[model samples]
Target: MVGCARVVNQTPTLPIKGESYVVLPFENYTETPYAGYRVASILEGVLASKGYNLIPRVWSINERELAVEEIEKLKESAVKNGARYIVHGSVNEFRYKTGLDGEPAVSITIFVYDAKENKVVKNVTVSGSGWVHESLGTLTQKLLNRAF
Candidate 1:
């Protein structure tokens, strides 16, 4: 069987093409180690391929999940870095189901903050299931592709 993904929720407004964006480290709510960083890397690649100017950050392996207050600080840092938009979210699920198929399942929520307007311009949630043969990374990339 092939993998499939669906959008759970999304705002009407899409991000403007060719805008400068800073992708903040996503919060990892799941037990999977570095799941947030994995998704963030995939998201960055996806956006970069679409021609968006992405500002890179030096990631620290010791960094912990971001707190609510840290999100505001990250947005401010994005603005200071001359990014027009800030992207961040949380990884709600990233694991394989323990059924006979051992199917891979992933769920994530993303938010796009417009620095210029000082508001959230977009919000999207996506989830998917992959066949037993599929890898979690591949399924995650596919789901994120559907998101933006």
Candidate 2:
């Protein structure tokens, strides 16, 4: 498989009601520069569009190598900023497929955590390929919706 994502815990639903969220910077695993920022921006836009208040801040820690202390600090900051939840993510893949079609492709993993409880709520991995003519942002949004 090109990509996959799952929550570490048993939470099956996200807090989709009247809750606020903070989106941390996503770690970009691919060679494409700014891919991580791109994913983070998209997530922020989508969440805001869904009627969630977004905490206007970017947690600039390395998501892949975050330590317990760093995570605690982040959670505390989010709580202080009045965010009910925070989202961390990684851009696992961000490039066009190398073939005749050269389709735009993206793979990402997102983790949602409860700011007050300092525990994960849900995580999801989603990958998608778009037609040669489609924009990366549109394809990413479609894939994200599927994951949501």
Q: Rate the local accuracy (lDDT) of all candidates.
A: 0.82, 0.75
The candidate 2 region of ten consecutive residues with least summed lDDT is 1-10
Best-matching candidate per lDDT:
1
- The segments of candidate 2 whose C-alpha lies over 4 angstroms from its true place after superposition are 1-11, 59-76
* Candidate 1: residue pairs that collide: none
Q: Provide backbone clash counts, one per model.
A: 0, 0
What is candidate 2's lDDT per residue for 1-148, written digit by digit as tens? 2332222322477887578788876767888777877888888888777777788774763535444466557767877888889887788888887888777888888999886677888888887777877677888887776666
Which residue pairs show backbone clashes in model 2? none
Q: For residue 62, what is the lDDT in candidate 1? A: 48
Worst 10 residues of 1 by lDDT: 57-66
Alpha-carbon lDDT of model 1? 0.82
Q: What are the per-residue Cα lDDT tens digits for candidate 1 across 17-131?
A: 7788988878899999888888888898988887888886634444566676776687787788788988889999999999688889999999998888888899999898887
Q: How big is the positional error of residue 116 in model 1, measured in Å on the Cα after superposition? A: 1.4
